[model samples]
Target: MTPAARLSAAIEVLADLEVRRRPVNDALRDWGQTHRFAGSKDRAALASIVYDALRRRASSIFLLGADSPRAVVLGMLRLGRGLEADDIARLFSGERFAPDALTDDERARLEAPIPDMPAASAGDFPEWLTESLERTFGDDLIAEMQALADRAPVDIRANTLKTTREALVSALAHLSPEPTSHAEAGLRFHAGDDGRGPALQVEPEFIQGLYEIQDEGSQLAALLSLAAPGEQVVDLCAGAGGKTLALAAQMDNRGQIFATDIDARRLAAIHERLSRSGVRNVQVRVPRGRFDPVRNPQVADPLADIAGTVDLVLVDAPCTGVGTWRRNPDAKWRLRPGALVERLADQATVLDRAAALVKPGGRIAYVTCSLLPEENDDAVSGFLERHADFESVAPSNVVEAAGLPHLAEFATPGGGLLLSPRRTDTDGFYVAILRNRAA
Candidate 1:
């Protein structure tokens, strides 16, 4: 496909995104299914263009004095992608599905946007989210948000118990573009020719459970939890067992791992991952909502069995995934303050209930992907204050021990780590280990 046609595809998908409530990824998938002839490169190019347009959606439209996908794409080509007007004219030329010829005003704006980008616009987020972004990121919001606007690399963590970094690297040779390990077991593969299949699904090693396709930042999340071999641990709120697998591998399949979640579907998904992972220690625990009384035996009530019994608990609590905008950009536009507040209510409830399962002196690694303090720092402080027995620990010590540098600088005053996308070249994650005091 010509560059122009690819741009045309982006315009179509973006228009669909604007009109329909469906996510960008969903729209792109539906679009691709309709056009099966599009090759991997063509699909990737079109997808990239559409996402780039979304990232700069506000600024691009504002600059071009238009909000349509065509106008946005035109502004993007000139501004974000550094295309000349002639280049856009060539791409959007009448020969292809590209937009009609750029209007004189668009051409002029293409030459120069109002300014580099106003404070709110540079973040490439909705104006309403600006206060939250600014509050969460402070002076660094622009830098981090800009990074998010770019493509997130394909991150994979080699299950050290099953495969070494070198071994997996050899296995991924056919995937082309050899992967470079960010941390000992973390691999980042450059996006390249893959026939448009889910990258890891095709690899035999992945099928055999040699590695798990998880973000490097996610790998760090599990690592920070410090699940040692032979230690009894409970992965409270383990959705789909992404970190549970990592914790299992860390335990060398030796300790008791109580993996629990409120959602049965998420727990059900972990079976395939666990079986493939060869992790024998994991015991799947399904929960009845906190309101469910113990008299009813029909619902799963595993959290009741282990209250104050485990040495460690990993609370991978749910939150607004503001930290993962690189992968799920459309969600930012969908979220409202009311919805976020409601989610926090759910989080606080989960935390209070989960805290009961952590034994005296046991550590609970509180976690969230959100950059907002409401979901992170505030949550930790509230939990610690409400439960006098619990004391917070600085995550920098754990992170630095994991070989991550410069994070010690962001350690919270009371305790915890606020990882902004700017300081950490990874997702926005807040992890704090709190230990319960003895009576």
Candidate 2:
């Protein structure tokens, strides 16, 4: 398909997403299913345009002076795809299968220089999140949010249980992988201008379980768990075992990791991943039916036998994922205050559960892929208030122990560490290490 046609399709998909309020992937998939003529490249290109448009949705709307899908596409061409006026006009020339010719007003907006925008619009984030963003970054809010608006580089963690970082880097040499600045086991890859990164998944090394696609921030969060060998650890919300596998490697597959999630469907994928990564120390646990998996009493509790004996409990709690904007930019637009509230509740629940499993003097590493203070600092503060037995530990100490001493500067004022796109050149992740008081 022509580039213009691809843009047209993207506009349609964006409109569908706006109207249906469905996920971007679901909208794109439905579009592809209906338009069978669009090949793989065309679908991918359309998806990219739609995603880029969403990433800069507020800025695009503000510049174009309209909220229509066509206006968004036009603005995205200027901002995200970096197309000149002539370039955008060419794509919208009303030629065969192209978008309708741009109106004089549209052309003028396309050619005009961008005006100084308000903090929320300038940062391409929700207006309601301005306070939260400010709370998180203070005077640096614009820079920090703008960093999130930018495209994310692909990062993968070498499965040290299967292969060393050096070995995986050699195996995927053509991709020009570089060691991540903070994550010792991580390698970074730059996605091309077209948003296409190397097909590392199809590589023989990946098939043989040499590496797993994980963000550097995520790898560092898992490392902050400080799961050493022969220590009992529980990945309380181990979705797909990304961190669980990392913990297994840290333990050198010696200690047991009770990997469980509330949703069994999410837990299903972890089994296959555990097998592929050669992680043996992790035991999968799930509660029966649609119930609270962590605290369910009727079902067999895999963690029951190890409760109060666990040295570490990693709570990769569910959140609004404000930190993952670079990858899931569309989600930011969909996020609501209600959703944030729900995630806060979930974080509290998971942290409380973790507190139960942790032995005296044992630690709970509360982690979230959220930049919102409500989910990070506020949640931790609330947890500490509720659980008198637990006290906050300096996250800098955890970073130092994890051998990323250089990252000590990223710790929050409350002793938790916040890794952000602007500050750490990684995803927005918050990690707080809290230790239980000894009996």
What alpha-carbon RMSD in Å does predicted model 2 have with respect to the real structure?
1.6
Q: What is the Å distance of residue 83 in model 1 from its true position?
A: 0.8
**Per-residue lDDT over 1-439 for candidate 2, one digit per residue giving the tens place of the 0 to 100 score:** 9998888888889889889998898999999999999887787778788888998898889999998988888888898778889989999999998999999999998898988899998899999999988988999999899899988999999998888999877888888999999888999999876777889889888888878999999998988888899988888888788899888887889978898887777887887888888888988878564346445645665567778998999999999999999899889989999998888888888888788899999999999999888899899999999999899988667877888888888888777999999888899999999999979
- The TM-score of predicted model 1 comes to 0.91
Full-model lDDT for every candidate: 0.77, 0.88
How much lDDT does candidate 1 score? Answer: 0.77
Candidate 2 matches the true fold with a TM-score of: 0.96
- Each candidate's TM vs. the true structure? 0.91, 0.96
RMSD of 1: 3.0
